[model samples]
Target: MIATPQSCQELLAHMVGFDTVVAYHSGVAEAERKLSDYLAGLATAWGFTVRELPIEGACGNLLIEHCIDPTLPWLMFDSHMDTVGVEGMTIDPFGGEIRDGRLYGRGACDTKGTGAAMLWALREYAAGSQKPRNIAVLFSVGEEHVQTGARAFVEQHLALLDWTPAGVVAGEPTQMQVLGATGGFVRWKMTTLGQACHSSKPDRGHNAIYDMARLVTALEDDYIGKIRATHPLVGNASAAITVINGGKQVNVVPAEATITFDRRLVPGEDGQRELNAVQALAAQVAASRPGMQVTHHQFESAPPMGTVDGGQFANQAVTALEGVGISSEVAGEPFTTNGNHFAAAGIPTIVVGPGDIAQAHTPDEWVSLEELDRGIAGYAAIMKS
Candidate 1:
């Protein structure tokens, strides 16, 4: 079930071989389990207490604990094990080919590659005699879909892992930069109902689609102002109606219409506030037409958090980066992550990892070999303090 560091890399290649792209409604299985087993075995080899967090029957988070003197607080570095869907790629999607100083495949950048880096770091620290503090490494799942994996892990095991020493580095694509701020994520669906009628009786039926289009136009303009009023980081809180499908084949006067929203609220803005504003907009549109009803529902949500420029926990890692050749600066982003959940739960969390976000989820997604080395060294330095 376990292997040497040299073999660990090969094991990781096998882990990535399974297409573990988590769909919120779907789940992770073989690949994620192998990943958990690999970490669990390594943790056991290194004298750690291992706990498995499962997602829809699969190992979600493998909490590996290495304790020495509990006198000092512990350090935790967390990364997800799931990858986004493989949409486009030129080579073998699961090949794990390491050519030209880069690893090419689906999970290479978005996650599994980072998982390999963390495993390599664990091997490095486990072999060293630095007498590192109680280091807890968490490899979480479902980060590509919902925050379910980490959210569940925190709810079930945060009390055990919650130690107050350094900080929690949420390993993600940062191109080796430490992230300070993260965007909020939310999704809503709006529907309009109308009385069904024959195609020839169109005049008699209040077409739901025509009514929904009116609401969509209103949503894209005036209602978004509520979000724009409190924009930060990259830009204003953004919203787009990504999906709209109604009715059967076009012969009849369709009785129903619906639109799905993709909204990105910036950090510092309460997630509930955006929901309320969108609801208000729906109410306003519904009031205009009493016969055709309008309703909205929230499908997904993640809170936003600002960056910490100079906190003891935040600065420790920043300070460590400077020890190497890397200079540090705080950054705020318009993307959401489990960091939102960690920060919401009162843990100081920041984003850090190798590779570029631009390459994430793309076909043939890859990370430079140099970034992997950098990520390993940088992660090792963070726990060194």
Candidate 2:
């Protein structure tokens, strides 16, 4: 049913060949479809069931079930099937080239590597080396998009399974560090409305840009401090005015100004509380600047997750990692990832995988040949134990 370590290494190269980038849309998300095809093939070849989750009128998540034995519980090896942009990749993002022992490609380190390792580990379990503890290998989609993949899997597919497994090891690039936390992201757009007037006269009309500018400055000087002053593992929260635009004509004061806000919060900071914080800050700014009405609204919200300790999943993960010759210590990440979705569902989740997160989605993005092997062996130890 399965092969040796070399067989697994070869499979990692194959997965890297498919450009499972974050850019996908419409019915079967081009990238997801490609991944689905590859995964379906693996399912058939490896004797696993292939199930597709129809997200937003399309196949959003791909679940490959490896039921080595029905009597044992499960061990979920989760990896995302989506990547970021491939704007200026020197090597073809989908080349899957293994040069000098390193794989040069887009999603190589970000996740494809983890997926491959998980696959190989499952195969090893199926290989009957020692009748590996019940386990299931999952290749989730849309992890780079909106975390819809993990969310769907946790809600829809978990019930479909006969055994929910001992725990889930979400493979995201931990560089081998056990990740137990993820900072929250709250994105919003603020618009300022004012009466249009001739710029030269300055008396007959209002300047929306000026109003927005005041809000931005106040937010930077005041509100930014209120929210950004602290965090436990991820450091202090942050907010930045990334975009702003308000101009109708050279001589006219624009009647509307818009600004985009990027806010990151530490765990325990409620999403709504963050929104309220913005609203409260805007009210203060408006009070100081007459005719400056700032409206705060949320466009995106990723609830944060805290470091999980004292849980069965955490203990088992620690033991599994230790059994593999690598001990794991619980840690947190400053950025947001799909782990948040499952964490929000009260699932004890950790984001760990190969490759340095620093190289993720970068131009010359690449993963070390050594790390790939460690990831495979480490994951195998987890599933087998």
Candidate 3:
């Protein structure tokens, strides 16, 4: 059965019904497990073999496989099962309501729509008389938060495949365009310590907030532009102090201050080296201030996806999209995705799918019904190409 816009929308509604938000971020356990099981069931019913890659303390990933020609190179499609929190949603986060030719839900655009399209494409191809290259669909978890599912897939399960992948298409909200490259991320915490005193006191104690103010000022004025590393596709690296906390009460002078530093790394830039540079600057700031202490702790780091290695696969994807009557082009984005992990693992990969990225994580998230139909056809074309 060929997939249609109405069928895609129905499947998307069912997918959106599952509250697959990452447990790490939402404090909800097995957030993706039910959806993984449900999707696995669908794949099994469609005659595709399914394997579960368990992610410790989380739902895990689903690998749905279908092979036709063993001698032919395999193609992989990856889409995350998890969505961000629905804290400020204006519509029903799980309703999957269709209004004005669009489907509304938390993951409607950012990517359950892609997931449904992939599933339908696989089903259609498997049921049809002709089979293209061997296919695998990986539904990964934790993409909205730490991306542990993708990392685990690359580190552990990727070697399990019998055939080398010709290319990997990572499903992101790319509006059917091919995202050839994307920026990376490194986040760490910086802390400043000082003596505590009453707010009314006249220079009785050092203010940690004041010290942190100087460090932030230095970062904004001196350090931000210093990230000279530039990638031809994703552009230059950048950094910002995203979160800060200092005082506990209005009348008390704070003794400690902490700020979270988030740095975006372009391809060819080292994440640890970026963190080290920030720490060095913090050390300099601390040395300049008398009786002040500054410390740092690194937390998250994700490598960037580069276009140079994935250019061929991206072009293939562009051709596939163009075949489906969509105007597609290879592009770059400042945001990171699971494609980074896949590309880092030496699999030529591109990020592409239906819907506008601007709709992702918005209060009224949506994906157009027409785009959903195109996504099914586009993914099916790539599967056969």
| Count of clashing residue pairs in every prediction | 3, 2, 0
Worst 10 residues of 1 by lDDT: 225-234
Q: Kindly report which residue pairs in candidate 1 clash with one another.
A: 88-363, 89-363, 183-335
TM-score of each: 0.91, 0.89, 0.94
User: By TM-score, who's the top model here?
Assistant: 3
Worst 10 residues of 2 by lDDT: 1-10
For candidate 3, write residues 203-283 as lDDT tens digits. 998899999999999888778867688877788788888899998899888999999999999988888888888888888
For model 2, how does the per-residue alpha-carbon lDDT over 1-385 read when each residue is reduced to its tens digit? 3222356557776677766666543223556667667777766776878777566644567777766668866667788877777877887888777788788788788888888877776776777667656666677777775676787777787787666645678887777777777788888899998889788887788888888888888888887866644565667778888998888889997889999998887887887877787888888878988777777664887888775454456556667788877768767777887777777776677778878898898887778778887788778877666
lDDT of 3 at 261: 92
lDDT of 3 at 210: 92
Residue-by-residue lDDT tens digits, candidate 1, 80-128: 8777666557878788887887778887888776667776776677778
After superposing candidate 1, which stretches have Cα over 4 Å from the reference?
A: 7-14, 23-31, 54-58, 160-166, 229-234, 307-312
Give every collision pair in model 2: 22-83, 74-165
Q: Quote model 3's TM-score.
A: 0.94
